[model samples]
Target: MAQLIDLKTFTDKRGNLTVIEKVVPFDIKRIFYIYGVDESKRGGHRHKQTIQAAICIQGSCRIYNNNGSSEAYFELNRPDKCLLIQPEDWHTMDQFTPDAILMVLASEYFDANDYIFEPYSAV
Candidate 1:
């Protein structure tokens, strides 16, 4: 199951700030974001060793994750509402708003070998 992490947020009259640290099991080595995806499409892939924490910094989206035996759904609406994904967990992202910005913090750097495209028993 993925962990729903409520990240540290500091708010003031000016604006709000959220901090991303090494609170997960591994240090963040790569950061990326997804945008301009249609609602009919989704992220249909999983990692073998890389862990990720996904957040919606702008707009909203939904994420579905499965780990062979169990499944979970997450609504990434706020920047502080982070979904910490572990290895071997299959995930798909969809239901994105028009201007949604999905940010991801990865435990490892960009490596094509880290992706596991094997078919798992997930629906």
Candidate 2:
């Protein structure tokens, strides 16, 4: 199962900056976003050894995660809150606000074979 990681965001007169350089548990190698989807649309099929941390930078989103035995729903709306997804966990992200921007931090570089696109199976 994945864990919720609450990040520290420092605000100042200039602006607000959230420093996540080497402070996060996983090694961030890639960054991506899921956006422009209509209602009832889902993303993320499966991952092998990749770990990801996702945050709703703008607007709100719901992430459905299943790790064979347990299922959990994470509602992300705050920029400081991020959900760290473990390997082999099947995640389906949906219920996004129209202007929602889902930012993801990946532990590994892009690898095509690391993703499983079929129906999720217990690993």
Candidate 3:
């Protein structure tokens, strides 16, 4: 089972910033963003070894994730809250606002062969 990481969100008169430096509980190796998708569009894929933590920095979106036998839905609307994604879990991102900015912190660097683009028929 994958764990959910709750990051600290600091606010001030100026603004706010949430930092997740190295040596934190979860090991982060890569950072990426998904943006500019059309309405109702979705990203369907899963990683073999990459664990991800995603945040909605600009707008709102929903994530549907399933771990073979169990499933979960996460509503990402705040920049401070992040959803931790486990390896080998099927995931789809949808219901995104027009200006949605989904930022992800990955546990491993990019490897094209590590991804499973097809859904598991047995699940």
The lDDT for every candidate, in the order shown, is: 0.86, 0.84, 0.80
Query: Cα deviation of 85 in candidate 3 (Å)?
Result: 0.3
Instruction: Give lDDT: candidate 3, residue 93.
Output: 93
Q: Write the per-residue lDDT of candidate 2 for residues 1-123, one digit (tens) a residue.
A: 878877888998998887666556876899999887688757566788899999888899999888877888999998888899987678888899999999999999999989876655653
The C-alpha stretches of model 3 lying farther than 4 A from their native spots are 1-4, 22-25, 121-123
Top lDDT model: 1
- The runs of at least 3 residues in candidate 1 whose Cα sits more than 4 Å from the true structure, single-residue gaps closed, are none
- Each prediction's TM-score against the native? 0.91, 0.86, 0.85
Ten-residue segment with the worst summed lDDT in candidate 2? 18-27
lDDT (10s digit) by residue, model 3, range 25-91:
4677889998876776575888888888888888989998877777778888888778888887788
Q: List residue ranges in candidate 2 displaced over 4 A.
A: 12-15, 118-123
RMSD of 1: 1.5
What is candidate 1's local distance difference test score? 0.86
Against the true structure, what is every candidate's RMSD? 1.5, 2.3, 2.2
